[model samples]
Target: MLTKAGWILSAPASVEDVRLEWEDGSPPGDRFGEAKARARRLLPWRTGAERYPAYSSALVQLAGRSQLYDGDLYRPTAIAGEANGIRLRFTHGRYFEHLDTTEILAYEAASRDLAGRTPADGRYRRWLKDPFDLTRRSTGLGTVTLTIRTAAGSAGFYMHKRDADQLAVGAGVVHAVPAGEFTPSDIGLEAIRADFDLWRTVMREYAEEFLDLEEAYGRGGRPLDYDHDWPFGSLNEARESGGLRLYVLGVGLDVLTWKPELLLVCLIDGAVFDRIFADMVTAGKEGTIIAGPRGNGIPFEFSNISRYVDSENTRGAAKACLTLAWRHRAALGIVSDVDS
Candidate 1:
């Protein structure tokens, strides 16, 4: 079986790693101020429609197969030929809709019926009880799990439980910062030039979560024009200055959703991490960083992330995800051990 973390695209053939620094006119400072201000105005995160909107196109089905290049010979399996997938239209940067439990219930019924008649391994047969993870891991829905690293180490974030979230009400989970669904906006579309790029989703989440630019910009509901020299410039600045290094660590399933999560590790210069961390701490102390409504935002330093997991504060699935990622600390540019 192909290991989930084997499909790392950290360095694609066409990508060149260049050191970038923002000089006189850049987004970090005076150079790209106008553009940053403009892109901030373009955010539409919380404005999702209540009803299911139209997809840009019809769903497309394809054969599903898993592959990994780890210097070992591979043989195709019968399951590879039997499995298939359908591409659902993107959420288009809208807030995540509530997970419809209808699918889970149906899968459970089908699995139970099959289990009664078939002779299968206990592990495979028992999966009917955990329908959420069974569908997530087996069906291959995609997600993005971003691990934020700073000089002090990786940063931890808290998720506020909401109706839309999978966790139970009043529960909290400690997660790597800015983890979210990989959207078409992250990849780019012909109709929307603004969101067209691989880094769009990651950096956009960074801006919204850490920078608080979304609420700040969406405050007045004021309309603003597009500024071409946008998010990319700021990203370039981060990459060039050695403040940020993004890696596609590999793919893994969220234990709860059983969805395919694209593991992305983001390393931030220690100084940059400290600055953001301190600011969030200040925000939390001032009660400016609300924890509810969407899950209050609680920030944790890299050194203390283990507390949540050990204390059982985080959900079981998130705990599994974090534990798996922590095993790759050195690869993710993290220097400390998982427990430390």
Candidate 2:
């Protein structure tokens, strides 16, 4: 088979259902930084920042806005699962270093080491024995959610067209809506403790991507009061009401950067979805909301699933998510109007 490279170790369970465990591990020294430093000494004349100035600046702006925080994010250090349950082990990882190695690859003519390997070839992922290596690189754990609106007999899902200028990876591509890197809602230790949960991270993204709420949630120097906040409060209440259903399909790695993603699906009753997202925006910080027939969600039928899964433009993470969702549609209670 002419196969494409994907997840290094994908379990039968999704990240959400896993019995997750974590170690508050300290920073693993940066492999990319060491390489960059070595390059600075070996061939100081040609530097990444100097050569890729435009791309570097855009990344700089993204980091400056705290969108790419240098703080700790959950790293899936280990995984063990079966048809019954999945147990995942995690550790604290440096958010900045992950971007340094992964996102920086998108820039044209990025750093090439003494051996003449460039970022185009994923030289940053060299430290690990494998592309999904966890040794020196800060392997990130992000979330990708496929939004399905279950409006009684008719059910469909929503997608997003990520803006090219938004970030380095997965940019300018169509992806499932409300996808994001897992991070704390605010700065400091309190947020670190509170936002550590996977569901919290997913809900926060919904607030940001769905409602177009300001991304700077923790700028006020206080942990996000999810119980008191607008979208967060409403989101929690809706979850309790059993109107919104969140499911995780599995996890996968990017063939390019080697980062892992927690693939998820948000199945919401059409009325509940509409009421909660009454003020939903068409486009915001992430990208434009892609609609389906007559501006509704793209049908969740077999044809639409096959169309996206077969399309080259759909992000690989999305393809995996949609493929898995379609496979388990009956389990997820997805009521398709057309053929299965």
Candidate 3:
């Protein structure tokens, strides 16, 4: 029978669970360990790039402020309650791309890389050149002044040009007055909210599937009759498969954010797993693999066996786990040893 704690632990056991956690806790984490752990679990399976491709609408607030400054700027704004404009200026030879925009292809254009001549003629041009004009005929968006500078001393602004039609689908517009004139208001806050919500959902689903796979695989090994009341009992069941079982554990935000690449590393090296298992035992969270097998009816115990150590060993182990997950992006769907 699944208890309340089991259900709570299992709540984020799958990708779908992770998603629901995020939806309930926008930007989560402020609540401390609970909300943050859910967020980290979901991050590995986030479809944020797919849902909010090109640029996040949440960033429009910053764009609104950008217009107040002088020079070439790429600011996303709404216009006339009908279209969204990504305003930007070109400065030097380099161009900027939108975070939401997907890069499809890149190829070298003909030689237009000179100081005096317009680089725009070569399919790419420095923003500093005067009389620089480029048009996205399909989107009805065009560029006029090529060279402009910000007070901060930045040389160029890059932008992702989107069609008015595509921009209208994500958000609505409001009215703002400036200098005695009225202009359409930018409400990208909604877009950002929606994008984040969608990402949370994707992460939860992934966690669920991962747990399911782990259970199915465990069943294929040995069957150990273990206590259902104790959380540690599940560890004994996992031992039949050679020290493997579904165990649900929480991780920290620092580990998730700064060491995202570590997920990929652990997956590649089995030794990383050994280190983590050892650490858990040392932390006084010991359990067994079978109850009735031994003469005293105790389970098999595994210990931390690493001789070579360092101050950052735990950090390294965490990084390895993160690296493994990242490397096997597809394997996130596999069953997790963690219960729930």
Q: Highest lDDT among the candidates is held by which one?
A: 2
lDDT of 2 by residue, 119-223 (tens): 445433343446444544555677889988887678888888887776556878888888887777776778767777888888888888888887754444656
Model 3 TM-score, all chains together? 0.17
Instruction: Evaluate model 2: give its lDDT.
Output: 0.67
lDDT of each structure?
Answer: 0.35, 0.67, 0.19
Expressed as tens digits, the lDDT of each residue in 246-265 for candidate 1 is: 65444443443334444455
Give the per-residue Cα lDDT of candidate 1 at 333.
52
Model 3, 1-340: lDDT tens digits are 1111221221112212221111222121122223222222211222655322222232333233221211111121111110111112211110012112111001111122334544334221111121111111001111111010111211111111212222221112110000000101112333223323222222222112212111111112333222342222433333344333121111111111110010111110123222323322211101111112211111111111111112232233232222222233233223222221
True-vs-predicted CA distance for residue 319, candidate 2, Å: 0.8
What does candidate 2 score on TM?
A: 0.81
The positional error of residue 59 in candidate 1, measured at the CA in angstroms, is 23
